[model samples]
Target: GGAFKETDRGQWAHVVCALWIPEVRFANTVFLEPIDSIETIPAARWRLSCYVCKQKGVGACIQCHRNNCYAAFHVTCAQQAGLHMRMDTVRDSVTGAETQPVIVQKTAYCDAHTPSISGLTPNANYVEDTISEKTREESRNKMKQARKMLAKKRSSVPVILIPTIPPERVQEIATLVSITKKAQFIQRLIAYWTLKRQYRNGVPLLRRLQSQGQTHTGFGARNGIEGSPDTSELYHQLKYWQSLRQDLERARLLCELVRKREKLKVALLKTHEEVVMMRLNPVEMAMIKLLDVLFQKDSNEIFNEPVNINEVPDYMDIVKHPMDLSTMRTKLYSKMYYSLDDMEA
Candidate 1:
């Protein structure tokens, strides 16, 4: 009845009650956000009778996070009784194999459920890591959905690996690579996604290593060979993954080599053209200018026209090689003349 706030979901909660609960958050300072966080309190908590108030407080009750302990209480009642409630920051397990860990807030409703602070003695009954379990559950559900979607036979549908990593890992990889290493990082990430080559679970490289215990068999378990050969499917499975990894490494090396070859090809072409131009074009240009001046200097233009074979039948006898202005111009235009000496000849 006192100072109530309405949520976006049309649910009303007492401001005092909301303030006491560690899970409730105000989206903004000005609005004092009546965020729809009431659902975070498990529905089973409502059914459990509150030990503090001795009432079945539905919609305004929270349970003890301790395992096998169904202790329930209202936020106001818990606060009045001086209960140990807190928001703890911990590593998020959903972001698997990331270089950097994702830190998230988790509400601790009991002293027993609270994580052991560093430099403090551990609680004997603290068996479950609530945040880790929650994140894992979320990851499992998300990967399942992604697998289902990817399994469809739709044409042109791009096959994207289920990004089991959180956004922070993407940012970390972005920070790790410079603009020049863009291609290298792209290839590396591609190889990273191509793990196992099975197109099955998007389990991270590190997680996959941890999950596979098939290779952990004890040595010399059976009496010699014959009956118990070491060539089991479990042993071969490890080798299969290793071979795939080797292939991926080779592929990465090949990609790098190809990139280098492309760069070299471009550079070689440019330099070759430059050397050719430097050695040949200037001499050709000077000869062309000389030819132009000589042609211009022919005042009567006698040499400009070719001597008709009939008019001067002995012209070929006098000149061993046939030459004319028109032929020279045609050769120059077609780039058939390799040097100034050839053009002059």
Candidate 2:
């Protein structure tokens, strides 16, 4: 009833539509049948959902490789079903070589379709029990060797001949002995040098004293100069000479004796001044004063009193006529006072 064209032949009404007597009774008259068959373009390589749980195969899963079969199942579902696996050969057309056999899962069928086995055969794989036994044997041998080495180390030395002193103590003993010997040698050298110095100074002093007809007093009190002869002997000798001068009426020789005594007194006073100056430090002066007071027995006089020029007696006043030993003894103290007065002045 619509526009008729040769291209719209089956596109309009199929030939089977004419089988109906009225053709209006047939469904094809209202809706035309497909003009051409569906084109089979190799099925588009689609991923099959798991046949057991019907979930998308996202993890380790297996697919049925039976003829015209596209059933898939997860690996745990396959193992629980106890299905047997088979191998299929796939050849690479570009390399013209057969690749390794690919495993084909047969888990789509139930236990009725496939036989089930409990465990894998030992001869089928080598890594499980065989490798574990070998590793255990190696570990045992290593432990045994370690234990033997520890035993040998513990019993390395004999029990009877153990050392009395530790090695470190023996070394320390040797060090101490060497140190003591070194110290003794140094001390001996110091003593030898000190004695040699004393001998060098003492010989000359002894010789000088012998020349002066006097005995050496160990070493000199000041600078190793010979000390004066015995005081008592000199006094007696001077008196004898003074008496001879008077008996011979020699006034000049008497004067010379008086001059000699004056010189002795002067020397004594100079020595006293040097000692006082040496103790001038406040600490030394105080200590000397304290000791003098502590050790004093009867006298209350201060030991280191300051000199007074006015208290000092004149030399001429004490020795107005120095003639013999009788006058000399009395005048000796006067000379001491005069020397002190001179120092104060």
Candidate 3:
């Protein structure tokens, strides 16, 4: 039989007991049941035992928690597990005082099975001082050598002098020859005027001597006169004729000399002309080559085998000189007419 009357004191005592107990038993079963449903029980469970105190329980001590809580062990086991658990009951064998649990993190050791963390040393300050110094010295030496090599490589070409005859000589010769020819021409005119005056004056004297029946001395007697006809006048006339002949010979010699000089001048001018022509010939050839390059229809043909005259529409622009045009015409005429003439011959 159960007492049904409930007092406040009894109910308060029951609540206090429920709070004090750490584990609550539901339906007197060892396994925990679901709190929401009576029919459901916990599907999986973990049996926790304190490894340090050798106690079986759900809540482990802090020291045993360091080790696997599921492994049950005594205080000695916890010390052996490297988790130091302090016990008031146990004492050290050597010191005769209660042993304090030493809590040190279990370190992994290196062996055939485990990894090691002891051999590694700090490498932050490690340096190859000697090798770095050698490399810097080598680089500086290379730079200095390069600068010296560049300085040594600088050089200059030697200057040379070429000698040449000056053009002033040609100009001087041309001026002298021109002035001499002009003076010779003027002397010839003066000589002709002097001979005319002498011939006019001698005519009347010869007539008077013939009328007076006098032998003209000198040239007059030699020409078949009997009287001595004015010897002085006769001598004057003879000397004038001799002077005229000498002047004519002198003029002829001067003309020959002028001709020789003119030929030399022409030779010099021809040389200069030929030099200019030689320089112009290359330019003309280049112009012709450019024209051929531009107007040719066939891509394979570099230059026409025989250049087509009709293809060059602006041929006159290239061959502008009258002499060149005449030369070309004469060449064409000779090719056409002389060939026919030779065939007929």
Candidate 4:
């Protein structure tokens, strides 16, 4: 009688069989005995069979090609042997890993069924090296291009010298000139004022005077007098006129410069006003228009203090051109003095 015992490994029904090779049997030897022999075995007597298909066999129990589990099967059984055997320990081409199961055919498993595992070694390091080299090359090329572009840009830039006329020099020159001596000052002022003139007026005058003096020895080059003055006297007059002309020109430049600066200031203010108005809310625009109309009414009242009929004639004439009024209104609005709604009213 066989005794069933649960071992440390798992449950097993052990039976002492008539020993065929007693000398080879070790004390630890645990034989896994099949329930039936193939010759006397009925379909019901085959208790354990192939894990893959439950078919009967004893010769060489083929392990499951998928899970490597012992699944006994006969060589000539209806079920095919090695159906899921992986002959080659290859990785799947799609997955790039060894986890994929290889499907075997009825024929001997070849590279066709079990894919070649030879070239499965990862080339990540090679790819990374190539990419790094390419990146370095591109970076180098970009740096070279940047350097070239900067050099070209630098080479193309033109040098301009902005003349800095000192304000103190301008003030000093203005003090020397009298408002009463207009014509004489205007003539003398040509040299200083026209020094930087686009046309060669100052240079032309100097050249003509020099030429005339050379032609006629009696003519004085410095003062343009009929007879030649002494060298020292001519030199002294020349130096005086030169200094005076420089001062006068500086004064004229200062006046013109002030006018230009005022114009620029007005233009900048207009631009800022336009930007602000463009972003203003509708309510703000309406308020601005009302303020502008009120300011205009006040200005008119101030001008007409004691309200003369003769003075009103000039005022009426000024308002004759509607287009001119609109243009003036637009310019005033650009300076934030009025709004479009004010002009409408």
Candidate 5:
């Protein structure tokens, strides 16, 4: 209420007042009680939208008494908006009346409900309006502000603190982007989304680099992305930014690897039974059966028991580590290998 004066009702009281609302005149102004009932206003006024607040069912509202104008509003709202609150005074008959005279009727009118200077037109109701001039006036003001802002437009992206890229580089990127269709010569270069995303990311990165000093320089420097000092930060600071950018890039790559590892883990779990069976080494009997092939790696004597050193005296020297298929069968029955990997090893 710094700029506002307190009324008879007190500071900010009129806004909350139920009796002091539009279409509600005080029957006894002395105590400001015994207000004119809301029943006095037409039901249509209650239903009509209030142009000022654009809401209904809040309080008693007054409407444009000008015929067919459904415009309704709170009294305070109407007064602030400068709508015509016409009062017809009772003149000369009453002797006890004050010099100000007696107001017999109080009526409100909208912008479109102004009195005709010539005479009453045939379609006076059509000329009258509701949800009228006040709402339109506000809309018009907002439209004017937007128009003013639009006047200072430019094609180039504006820089608040630091620009994303050098103006020339941005222009080069723009030239490449302007041609969207695939051209054999520029097929690799025409990455519209990549260019846009990098440009978008560069904006915040430049701001961070500028604010954080040399901490983020090394990363962008290694990648040859940081520009001249005239375009961005100094050389050493750019180098620090390059380091930071590289660290962040590594972090991004590691995150992708971790995601793939988790997916692989889930896949392994789904086929856990098959893997377990493979590790069980159930091929011991199969290997024994395969040994039946006669003299496959050497002589057919391998199917029978080992030849004794007594019969062939050179056997102890030549076949010092010999073991026949029958000996292998005995080892398999003894459970020497628990898994296929162990058996192969």
Candidate 6:
């Protein structure tokens, strides 16, 4: 039976047929024998289909546009079948090595039916690079600003220089006869005592200041002022003024002490015993040592003994016979004697 072939299907078939010339070419001469027998395929097999699943094309299908391979895929069907979307890597030209793998898009296929993607440029990772660079720049700017602020603060402070005191003058000052400016010497003394005076006085100066009522407006305002001031306010104000006057008198006395220090030192030597009697045991010892230079006596020579006031008969006996009690009085009154001295010098 003579079988007819459909030859006039399209211009492509017509063109191919027109260009055909019977000749001894390698392609034309090859595969003339039927080594593989052709079997009857089903009508469905002849339809346009998805190359991956071998199913007839129904809905949207992804087709590869590579040379010699136009494979079609039903990616949705593959997804429904729980198949993973394929990935591929691009190569760096200089190193001729593979780069990081990127996701393949449904519109394209890779070489050898791997997977491909479209619209993914090499500059995609640059977005993250730019963000990181911006953050780094901002941190650097903050550090620079902080450093500038620190430098400004350092530059703003005024440097104070302390004047050097001479050794000769220091000895003179120790002798309390240094004829330097009294104000300067007193200022330095005040500064020295400010640090050393903690708890030295029987009454704390802070509590005294508080009891006298601070002249500062903040303290007065904090306590509150009535439109018609109370008697308590007047009392506090009077106390404040009195404390100020006392402070002024104290400073004046100290200044006078400094100005006539030589004469005062002589007077202190003459009245050393009386001064010692006025002091407590610890202060008495310190005062004796301090006056030893003026008195021309050794600190070790100073001694303290508690005096029995009742044994001392007369006012003169309290001073002249401070440690000596009358034997007759001691014998008459075994435990007591009459005297004027509360404390004997």
Higher-scoring candidate on TM-score, 3 or 6: 3
lDDT of 6 by residue, 143-229 (tens): 455445544644795433434456577666667755668657866875664544433432223543443343242244334432225
What TM-score does each of the candidates earn? Answer: 0.27, 0.15, 0.19, 0.20, 0.26, 0.14
Candidate 5: C-alpha lDDT:
0.53
The model with the greatest TM-score is 1
Model 2, 286: alpha-carbon shift in Å? 99
C-alpha positional error of residue 298 in candidate 3 after TM-score superposition, expressed in Å: 29
lDDT of 2 by residue, 196-308 (tens): 54655433234544434332332232243334466445545656775785566445656766886787677778768758855664444343344444446425543224333
User: In model 6, what are the clashing residue pairs, if there are any?
Assistant: 310-337, 310-338, 311-337
Give the lowest summed-lDDT range of ten residues in model 6: 20-29
Off-target runs (Cα >4 Å) in candidate 3 are: 1-229, 283-345
Model 3 TM-score, all chains together: 0.19
Please, what's the RMSD in Å of model 3? 67.0
List where candidate 6 sits over 4 angstroms from the true fold.
1-47, 80-106, 115-345
Which numbered prediction scores highest in lDDT against the true structure? 1
- Candidate 3, residues 1-345: lDDT per residue as tens digits? 111222223221122112112232232122212112212222221234443333454322222222232333323223333322222233335631232333322222111111112322212232222225554455446445543543343343333332232557545544655555765665564456456545554232335544333333333544444343455565567778867966886687689779867877777787787678658664443443444444455455533343445897775687663233233334434553233233223
In the predicted model 4, the residue pairs found to clash are none
- How do the residues 169-274 of candidate 1 rate in per-residue lDDT, one tens digit apiece? 7677778767876767766776667664326455345533433422353212131221223435445565678678668866876897798678777777877876
TM-score of 6: 0.14
Better candidate by TM-score, 2 or 3 = 3
Each candidate: what lDDT? 0.59, 0.41, 0.39, 0.43, 0.53, 0.41
lDDT (tens digit, per residue) of candidate 4 on 91-202: 4567313234453222121111221233232243533443355544554464455445434544794434323446577557767777987556755665454454324422
Candidate 2 segments whose C-alpha is farther than 4 A from its true place = 1-47, 57-60, 87-345
